[model samples]
Target: MPNKHPYTTLISAANLLPNAQLENWVIIDCRHDLSAPEAGRAAYDAGHIPGARFAHLDHDLSGTKQAAAGGFKGRHPLPEQDALIATLRHLGINDDTQVVAYDAHGGMYAARLWWLLRSIGHASIAVLDGGLAAWEALGQTLSTEAPTSAEGNICAKPTLVASVDADDVLKNLTNPQRTLVDARAPDRFRGENETIDPVGGHIPGAKNRFFKDNLQADGRFKPGHQLHEEFSNIISASQTAVMQCGSGVTACHNLLALEIAGLHGAALYPGSWSEWCADAGRPVATGA
Candidate 1:
């Protein structure tokens, strides 16, 4: 059978080194800036972990943006399954491949890939703990050359994660069964920072969690017990959790943190705020 110890959530730089050369392992560099979209590819061209291929956040990970009923789909919508499968295949990922994704900014971008993989039911994926900084700090060498592999034969399987759309989120405002956790910075959540999306504030009842809280000063994730304790304070026993951010990107970071915290079954609000605020009719709430 496939590798016995496939990392499904987070893997450290040290543990990754020994298995870096394995044929079954595929590393992807998912470094991207939301403002300067091209910056990620440029950084990849400079140097990346050996055998790591680049997956652009916009082109590879997300779906096309088009008009929806009330307004537009979010900036980064989920990709069509066939398109995602094709991208994975082109990147040499097989069904059994142990995929590891990393980026410079903690695991924000990398976590997107990790969640996408799980959405396709490929559970053998993980984020590089502390990301590229951790790898470099370990005195590991980087490679400028690219690697090639035969196309992957992977296909979509049943989704391992859950996702809610704008309609579901709208309904939640009234029914409020699921707990909506906003992963944006407090300023943004408060509608004070409108630099990213056109509208500020958040969905009516979203609890501000700020994705960065999951990280330590060194950029690594906090210990599992600590994460569990912190998340427990926000999410109680009765509510199902739903994670969201600007365009469903950094929200994955929170989802990863939840998984690390031993809290499972949290769903993603894929369109998130960008989609939620697109329509003027949708209710918005500002302030803490």
Candidate 2:
């Protein structure tokens, strides 16, 4: 069983200011540019929240990709369990540590880290509400000085956190009780302007939510009640919802939004479109 922690889903920069100096708290800068790849570290080096550590999506979070045998495991496969345990401990996260992750692109990348922690059964994590922009807006200081702390003794207690594999997704297509929500943009979901994946279009019966819908104009998440209202129409509190995106990254934003909305039990399809499309026999759907 995964360990449980009493942590809120979102934490404001203002609320985090006082706790920033605590020894048991960890702030991770999850900023990343999917295109540039190295841009996240460069930006972190320039300036990041005080006492924040950098987490690279591809290097720190994902596992190695062996796309040799035509059985590639998607672009960003989950990191090996032991490797993830080492990375978390290196980041100074222990059982009681309060983790706050932030990113420039809304909470897209940061939510991935948040989801990973929760999947490991460590719920003492939250996404910095409104992200780094929210912190900057409050005039919080950014530190070029890398904060160092002794390595932590946190251990991984992995749990199967409501995720479905490609085969399960295929089986769910005919199951009316389940709903597949794609977090990609409308264009990408419709297979109109796809440039990343070799094949375009979404799963046969998937609906597009475009993760950004959960955010306001300022890039912060919408209020809880508002979020609940927006999602209630698509997924009920009791329904089983599966989230997915180009390569299992942005889909986490949807999962975060669902949690914020108090609509729980949504699972992640980590293999997502990247792995689903890898098999030529899988069905694809396009257009409005």
Candidate 3:
């Protein structure tokens, strides 16, 4: 039976338990360390939610990096449509598959998968709120054994999510059509940290809204109304929002928070600051 209440944005571990074993459901472990790329797979190999398949951020989720005439595409570009479709099929994700993506990092990585699915027009996907900790807190068992399934026949559809490129963002800098929201930490946004990306500061007009703020102390997302109020303060009712971050990964966390807050039509800047700062011609801003 199809899940009567299919999860679109976020799913609790308790709600997921009942349908976990269902054939139409696919659980993905998206645990990833930006610094140590191999750590996510190692952690998955050590133990994960039973029957969960691993999706590496670099291998499965991101696309090949390109060297353009001006600058390189950000670290993690969106995967090719066909390549992404192949990955979904390999993961046994059908059109109706209820994908529940989880990670140890407060759904930071899982939200990437969630947004990717939505970008390909798959609406039945969700991030596991509170992630693996939530499941273990409920006394769920982990498994080292990997599970396989028949290849799926899911196809691509129109993207349900919106996105913008570096050009669009540059235009926005002068024309000011949209409000840019930076999802990186305040220190990073303020040009105080340069360990990850070569650039230290953020786009000139971008506002800092660290993705962690969307989560509570327990690592779960705050209530929709609360998220709405917080985000509204950053973005005005008349202004369209554009979300960005280092290499464009965590921006999805903000996008997911926007969805939870019922604020729709926000666009993702996939290249983000990593790409923006790649070309020195582009302007940069520092400080709060």
For model 2, the superposed segments whose C-alpha errors exceed 4 Å read 1-6, 67-70, 158-160, 237-239
Q: Rank the candidates by lDDT, best first.
A: 1, 3, 2
> Model 3 over residues 1-288: C-alpha lDDT tens digits?
455778999999999898899899999999999999999999999999998999999999998878435447899988888999999999999988999999999999999999999998889999999999999999999999999899988888899988999999999888998999999999999999679888799899889999999999999999999999999999995138999999889999999999999998999999888889988999999998
Task: Single out the weakest 10-residue window by summed lDDT for candidate 3.
Answer: 63-72
The TM-score values for the models, in the order shown, are 0.97, 0.94, 0.97
What is the Cα-based lDDT of residue 166 in candidate 1? Answer: 86
Q: Model 1 — TM-score against the truth? A: 0.97
Local accuracy of candidate 2 as per-residue lDDT tens digits, 83-134:
8989999999897788899999989999999989888878878998889989
List clashing residue pairs in candidate 3. Answer: none
Clash-forming residue pairs, model 2: none
Clash number by candidate, in order: 1, 0, 0
lDDT of 2 at 38: 98
lDDT of each: 0.92, 0.87, 0.92
lDDT of 1: 0.92
